[model samples]
Target chain A: MNIYIGAENIISPLGSTAEENFGALSKNSSGIKKTEAAGFDKKSIFFSRFAENTNDFSFDALLKNCLKNVRSKISPDIFSSEKTLLILSTTKGDIKSENVNPIGKSVSELQNSFELKHAPIVVSNACASGVIAINTAANFIRAGVYETIIVAGCDVISDFVTYGFECLFAISDKPCAPFDKNRTGITLGEGCAAVVLSSHKTIFNVEPMRFIEGTSGNDANHISGPSRTGEGLYRTVKKTLELAGITEKDIDFISAHGTATVFNDDMESVAFDRLNMQHIPLNSLKGYYGHTLGAAGIIETAICLQSMRNNTLIKSMGFEEEGTVKKINIISENKKLSLETVLKTSSGFGGVNASLLLKKS
Target chain B: MNHLSSYCHISTKEIVTDKGALLFDNTEGLEVNDFLKTVYKKLAIDYPKFYKMDSLSKAAFLGVELLKKENAALAEYADDEIALLFANSNASEDTDKKFVNSYAEEHAPSPSLFVYTLPSILMGELAIRNKWYGESLFVILQKFDAAFFADYCNMILLRNAKACICGWIEITEGKTEAFIFLAEKNGNENNTPLTKQTIEKIYKTIMKQSRPSKV
Candidate 1:
């Protein structure tokens, strides 16, 4: 069963929609900027972002736009009430009520906003939520549960998460430099991406990107931090390859979850070293998209799929001098290649980790 | 061929299962931490940080332990030998609210509390408790889908996972509800074929039955 990721819709710092965002990627632009939210003003944190709020882009509007984009690309009749599942990955999932309206504390009030009558599954797995959302949809496809599953991951930089990261002392007050020697902390950003996966071999006279295989694991080594040895990540990467019947050499490009945090970059470097994939052209989209939290996996995965279709890999924007971690060939500039398969890897708090293999059809 | 034979449900003030007897049932809705402390007292388990663990951690802690007691063979598997999947309707929104409130007040957010905000942490805690770690996944759904539940079990078995814990847990407004089942693959060379009809029938029956703990 070929799970196709067709018509990825994204809204990030660069711009909204795949065309706008990918245009920025191709031009080597940086989306990290000083945030102007009232929440940030109260806090002393300087460097952060809220996705450029284009006119009339509310949460509902974003969903409607994403659905519209996908609708234009795929046939509506395909999803005619056959239990087409909608699995969402998000952290700041309409959580304004809990912050504004003081109730006894329930997340359900926030979840109530995600009631898509056609698509009704939501996943809030912290940073790895997006990958898990994709995994959830793909598993349903493999299990023959639903014919079509729409995996959408989106999160806005809310006062809830923004100040929460600030309180943890993990937010960078300056532009984030992922994998850099002097990297201080992570910069937050917002984006939403929706991917439609189906058991159909092809769709709409287009060959959708194929989801070959993927794996997820937990280090159980820490509650908030990742393993220094990258044991969980290494195991997940190896298992992903094994399940896909591919090898380290088979992966053409590596889309790393480089959040510009000190620990995550270091840990991922060790994981890549163990996998003997150091020379692979690797880059993190965090510099461009900021850390979209739960949406990072889907947002980055969408970009990689777009790049695969165009046969080009976007450069890592903020990477310059190598950090204290092991060295890899970071794509500092856009490059063209016969990229067949790309590996998208992400690790999050609670020692949760995941890697997905995407192949160009 | 994995099937949910029996299951259990635990909340802030109740422990309901198909044991034909009530373990503990109370109407007073204890706070999240205090409820977990009660779980410790009743189960006679010793861990200094019982109250400090996250909701998923506490729930998975209780679910896996009770599951082990029912099926002791679960202990023999390797770290990644068995599969664990969790579905939450609303994950850690309360925690996120608390963290934000604390941050708004300039208080240092506890990493311990930050840890539970992720829905998958519960499954991780279960893996750490028992060495079984074959394939683990955590999902947040608006609600449980019987078809998706059965589909998940089939994939776990197809991926060669020996046993799977497939269920849902939700904690909101001082109320926590969790349902966990220990499902092992059918020994048959061919998996037990479960179609939508059989799953819906099971769901209808289970939905209508009264709480065994209350009985």
Candidate 2:
């Protein structure tokens, strides 16, 4: 049984739709900018936030808007169908809310607004939430628990999160330069992205890509720090390839989770090198998206779908010179290529690493 | 069909096993952290990292520790054979509030508290302790749903993992109710079949007997 994935939607600083974001990416546009006095110490910090006002409830707005856009792209009957289940991937949903249960209200709001057949399951595994949510959706479809699953990943920029990162000194001072020699750290961003996975491809108005296989692994090393050996990332990619019945050589491109923190990009380089995928052209979308946290894996996967559709290799936005101990073929220029199969990987806090494969179908 | 090999429940007042055997009762009226320390001492766990973890991680660690104590064969599995699938209602809300207070009231964001803001950190703690590099995921549900756990655990066990350590660790508003269970391919005659009804029954039975502990 093959899971078909399509109807990709993105609500980010770059644009509201996947096509628009892809267009901006093709032009090497970055959403990151220096915000005045956004840091805990009142220091100017770089952030990739929505240009339009989100009216204080950015989390809710992003979800509602992204879902509405996703609803438009798929068959109308799918939303009302009992076989469809909704999964929300978020690190923090409305953290600014006074209520202790920050995500419950948003889940209810989304279900009520969309008239979803079932209550959405929320995945909140730090930064890996998005990819794991999509993987969970595919797992459900394969298990015959649901025919169609809509996975939405969203996180908003707030003082709560920003200050937390700032305290940890994980926020980059400049627009994040992932995998670059001068890379500092992550530039936090806000965005929401959703994709529809189904057992049948006919539900999508556009041609859907084959949801090959997705898997996650833990580093078992640190809660906050990535492993020096990239054990989890390496294992997940290997597991994904094995489950997909493919080889490292078959992966044409890699969408790596390069958070631009000196350690993360280095860790990914080691992982890819260990997987013998060092030669495969890879790009970290963080240079453009600025590590959008929970929304990253979905948005980047959505971009990969668009790349497969357009047959274009989007450049690693801020990468210039090689940085890591293990060399990786980072795409420095946007080029057209025959991308048959692409691997998307993400590593997050809590020692979580996830990888998924998507083949052009 | 998968098997619910071993399970442990940690509530505010006491700890219980799958057979309704009381492991430890909190007669000291200790706080959340103190209660976890008491359990850790009772189990004779030497991992000093337990002292550094937040309430959610402590609860989950204790729950898993108790489960492993009951199922000695679990330690024989390969490092990457066991997966961690945990869910909760509030999602690190207990720590989130403390972290928020650090910046809002204390005038400085506490990095230590901030790191524990995600509930998945507990899984990381488990992975580090057990050196299990298998799959790990943390989901937020409005309430505990046994069907979701059974179906998801079955899917994960079929495709990615050989055994799964699943839990519903909810620590919010000074209340801790962590129910951690292990699901494996084979079951002994005494083990229960992994099903929604059995899981719900076990959870309810544990919750009904728990007396809320004072912080």
Candidate 3:
């Protein structure tokens, strides 16, 4: 089934909404900037950030805002209590409260901010949650349970995320480089993205930007680290391609997860090479959008969908030199191409890997 | 066939099926942790490592033991044929809180405390223990959904997994509570059509009977 994702809103170091985010992507402007957080003793940390103006935003309010913006653009009557299922994904939902306790509370003790507002289904599978959420929603829609399903994902950077990454020495103090050999560590960012999928692709007059054919897999390796062989990612991409009923040759552009970290980039390269897709044009949005964590998957999906709609492609920011894994062609400059399909993949802390195939409609 | 091979719940030592009971009530309190010590002791696991494990891992530890005790007919098959699926609320908020709290006080976090942050780690630990290298997933939905469970099980079966170990495991405070069932491929040609109602019916009944009545 072809799933349509329309009208996305993002709060990243790039920009808050699609307009700002797109503008930043076109200009090759990065949202990563130096900030003095409370806990870190370091003078500065480079973060691809979304403004933390969430004081006025409740879980319900955020959902409503996303709904409101999307609703205004699309037909509101299409989703009026029409048995729409919501599958929301996030790495840190209301982690600000957890930062107060060092030992952590039990599952029942944790406050579920998203549950308090909307009755949508939630996912927190580390970084892989975003793509899984979309894939799950797509499956639900494809199964004919709900006529339409709402896929929303978000995560905010806080002391917990910062300190957690810092403990692992994964945070880079400067803007990230997607596939660059000199890349150091990832820069954390915050953002939210919402996509609506319907069973009938012709619901809205707008042509379907992309068709979601994605899959999720677990590596069963180290918990915090990605699999050294990229087995998880390799399998995920393979599964995604299998489900899409297409091989690697059908994909035009690759929206790489490209956290610009050492192990991650190398692992992605191995997976791409195994698929015999090293010649594909690829770049990481993290260099432009700042690793949005949970939101990165859906946000990048939206960006690719939009690029497909506009018939334009963007380049990887801060990508100076190619890394050791020299299989794929990294997009160095913005280029226009006949893009029919794009492959976007994300690997998270847990041995979780997810990949999605989106086609230009 | 797609029948109950063998399933167990270590907490309270009471294993109930649609047919009858295996053990009597042993402990009190709505908490899940009260009886986890027995699980640790029975498994002969180290206290410090056991204490440091997350609720899902502990629940998984107990679940795997139950699967082994029953040693269903399907256990003789390939280990990769068995799938593990978990569902829970609260997700990893507790671990996140602990992780954040570590840095919250001083901003410096110990790597040891940082390990259990992901909810799926429990699944990984359980895999390492059982060597069950089949399909696995950790889903966090609002409350619980039977359709989701049924759908996931069907997907596993579609992937041609020989058997499945699936359930809901939730723990808060020190309390751990779980209800898991082993499902095998059934019928001639090894096919069984299971619905959301089938899984939910057994889940609700086992879960209700496992807990002491309020009265």
The lDDT leader among the candidates is 2
Q: Top model by DockQ, which number?
A: 2
Q: After best superposition, candidate 2 residue A5: deviation in angstroms? A: 0.6
- TM-score of predicted chain A against the true chain A, for each candidate: 0.91, 0.98, 0.89
| Candidates' C-alpha lDDT | 0.71, 0.89, 0.68
Q: Which residues of candidate 2, in runs, are more than 4 Å off?
A: A52-57, A97-100, B211-215
Candidate 3: residue A38 Cα off by (Å): 4.3
- Please tell me which model should have the higher DockQ, number 2 or number 3: 2
Docking class of 3: acceptable
A238-278: candidate 1 lDDT, tens digit per residue: 88898888888898999999988889899999999989999
Ten-residue stretch with the least lDDT total in model 2 chain A = A49-58
Query: What DockQ does each prediction reach against the true complex?
Result: 0.42, 0.83, 0.39
Off by more than 4 A, model 1: A36-55, A81-83, A97-118, B25-32, B104-111, B131-134, B187-215
Best-to-worst TM-score order:
2, 1, 3
| Candidate 1: residue pairs that collide | A122-B140, B79-B133, B80-B133, B80-B134, B81-B134
- Candidate order by decreasing lDDT: 2, 1, 3
What is the total number of backbone clashes in candidate 2? 0
After TM-score superposition, the amount by which residue A110's alpha carbon in candidate 3 deviates from its true location, in angstroms, is 19
Tell me how far candidate 2 lies from the true structure as C-alpha RMSD in angstroms: 1.6
